[model samples]
Target: MNYETFAPHPNLDAIVKCHWILEVPGDMEAPKQRVIPDGCIEMCFILGDDVKRFNSENEFIIQPRAMVFGQITKPYFVKPTGYVNTFAVRFYPYGFANFITQPIHELADKETPLTSLFEESSIKELEQKIIEAASTKSRIAIIESFLLSRLTDKSIIDNIVTSTIDSLSQTKGSASINSILKDDLSKRRNLERKFSKQVGISPKQLGRIIRLQAALKMMLNKPGENLTQVAYENEYYDQAHFTKDFKEFTGVNPKQYLDNDQMMLSSLIYSKD
Candidate 1:
């Protein structure tokens, strides 16, 4: 397996986290990979083969060739049909709102085909251009051009939402919403409304996911660290609290996650970012 990420164009840096590519050798057996919540949305294009997203223990549907995967609150399983090759855009929690009309919260835990979001004709054309691109660099250029052209007039991000997200991110999701808004407690409900539309998840939920992400990073980067240490560093109340949240989002306990095949894709994406 080969996974890599590239910085987005300077102009897109604020909205886009990075562009990434994943490739698995055709001869190797690809394992079912678990994708966990990370408080972001993704726009992906499959260039090699179709992938399956499991909806139940045995049931799953093929993911669209060009699709936008909205904010996911639960972990889901995906496996390659054959060799895996994909190019994807990782957008900030509020970044994708600038390109669409629908309330982002409505898109939670769903994968919408690109055609549904954009004009069918344009999406078909964009897919062709991306598939025909000569290299990864060319593919990134194609996507950047497409995003730039579709940029919406709707504000890219709400100022309140941005500030709340900034605080959560800065504290690795350990920030208290009450404390963050101590100056004006009355706006709590208002913040929730904004989060629903712009962030696709409530402020508290996003913070939990962000904090879990921080702990996941610690586990990935410091293999020798124990749960107690990881939890303390991330500000979790205790090892039990950390373990519960970890399993809530990842569907597995910390020990099982440490050296598991199921976490390979997610680990690569998170550890690097």
Candidate 2:
């Protein structure tokens, strides 16, 4: 398995987080990998064989070849059908809304093909370019060109949403909406409405995901760190509180996360982030 991320173009640095690529050999026996919410949206192009997202023990669906997967609230499982080669754009929590008119909340917890969001002809052309690009660098150039063309003054994300996200991120998701808004109840209500539409999840949900991500980084990087220390460092109420939230999102506690073979993919991705 090989996974890597690249910086976005300077002009798109604010909204676009990074462009990533992943490749795994076809001959390897791949297991069902668990994917958890990371408080972000992704636009992906599957450049190799198909992938399956499981809905239940016996049910699964093939992910779109060129698609935008919305904000995920909980963990899900995916397995490669064969070789895995994918190129994707990781957008900030509020970033994807700046390029589409659809209500972002409507896209949560599932993958929507690009044709549904943009013109069919244009999407086809863009997907072709990405698939045929000679290298990852060329693919990044193609996607950036498409994104820059779609971006417009009217599509700019709301300032309140961006600033609030900044505050949450800076505090590692510990900051409350009231504190960020200086206890302005009216503004809190307004922000909640816009945040759901623009980010596909509530402010509090995103905060929790962000905080979980911080804890995950620590656990993966510092293998010797205990749960109690990890919880305190990330501002969880206590180890029990931390374990509850961890299980909610990951379907497993921190100790299991480190030892679970199924977490191989998620661990690789989170460690890099």
Leading candidate by TM-score? 2
* Per-candidate clashes, comma-separated: 0, 0
Q: Note the residue pairs that clash in candidate 1.
A: none
Relative to the true structure, how large is the alpha-carbon lDDT of every model? 0.92, 0.93
lDDT of 1 by residue, 43-116 (tens): 99999988999999899999999999999999999999888999999999999988988999988998999999
Ten-residue stretch with the least lDDT total in model 2 = 150-159
Q: Which parts of model 2 are misplaced by more than 4 Å? A: none
lDDT of 2 by residue, 80-155 (tens): 9999999999999999998988789999999999999999999999999998899999999999999999888644
Candidate 1: list runs displaced more than 4 Å. Answer: 152-156
Question: How accurate locally is residue 211 in candidate 2, as Cα lDDT from 0 to 100?
Answer: 96
